[model samples]
Target: MSALSPSAQRVQAVLDGFGLGHRVVEHEGSTRTSEEAAASVGCDVAQIAKSLIFRGKDSGRPILVIASGVNRVDEKAVGRLIGEKIERADPEFVRASTGYAIGGVPPVGHAVPPLVLIDADLMALPMLWAAAGTPNAVFRLTPEELSRLTGGRIEAVRKG
Candidate 1:
């Protein structure tokens, strides 16, 4: 009903550049959390792809863990993969690095692109719903498509 937000527009441009221009969908209210997004789209939580940000203690850079909605990332495993200790990213750092708020960052199109690790569990689903920039905007893609788009490594990041 309303115009697309600036964040959504940026994401759209990025998606278009990647030839994934047909997937963006805008909805009302805040789909800030995976649970909220799943509820908004009337899908199982596992179908929501959550783009989580982490701070790399060793590299002093950002890291993104594209986790399944129903799973939590195991930082230890991720740190092992990246040769660094990992911590949850702060809101300021998240915004500065991703050009998005903590709840609205997409898997791609970041201000400071980070190393991405996708949850292997997400690959089990045929399709996934990911944040498209704003809290209420989303896009659909296959897990493989997500991997290719972000150049992310597929890993078992889900908590054990």
Candidate 2:
């Protein structure tokens, strides 16, 4: 296999550091979107862990929400949970905060530690596929492993 991209390697290193045995795989096609990642990984859309970053309007902090691909985040509800309103982070903010570009933000290994929240729906899945620091790179892990890796509060982040 070819070497993983530098960004992917960073994610792999973080996985290794955490003693998680998950393997990062780079696909020939794009895994940049939820549907694309699901097809690439041969998983249901709901099994894709989509990482979204929001900017806290008050603190200017980054808020990471790892939501299931099939779900839409209720931003207002999340803002309430975090005690502040949040706005969609722009590309520059995303890169500056997470050290990864949009469509490839991982649930872990952020340059600036973000307040994270995991979608409660994802906890029901047996396995999940997540972006691994690049648009074409991904990794799989059990819901339990995800919880361990992120330490993100599991909440009802999905739109009701």
lDDT of each: 0.90, 0.96
TM, every model: 0.96, 0.99
TM-score result, candidate 1: 0.96
Name the candidate that leads on lDDT. 2
Q: Write the per-residue lDDT of candidate 2 for residues 43-111, one digit (tens) a residue.
A: 999999999999999999999999999999999999999999999999999999999999999999999
Evaluated at residue 35, the lDDT of candidate 2 is 100
The number of clashing residue pairs in each candidate reads: 0, 0
lDDT by residue for model 1 over 1-160, one digit each (tens)? 5667889988988999988654677888778889999988888899999999999996779999999999988999999988899998889999999999878899999999899999999999998999988889898899989999999999999888
lDDT score for candidate 1 against the true structure? 0.90
As a whole number from 0 to 100, the lDDT of residue 37 in candidate 2 is 100
The residue pairs found clashing in candidate 2 are: none
Which residue segments of model 2 deviate by more than 4 Å? none
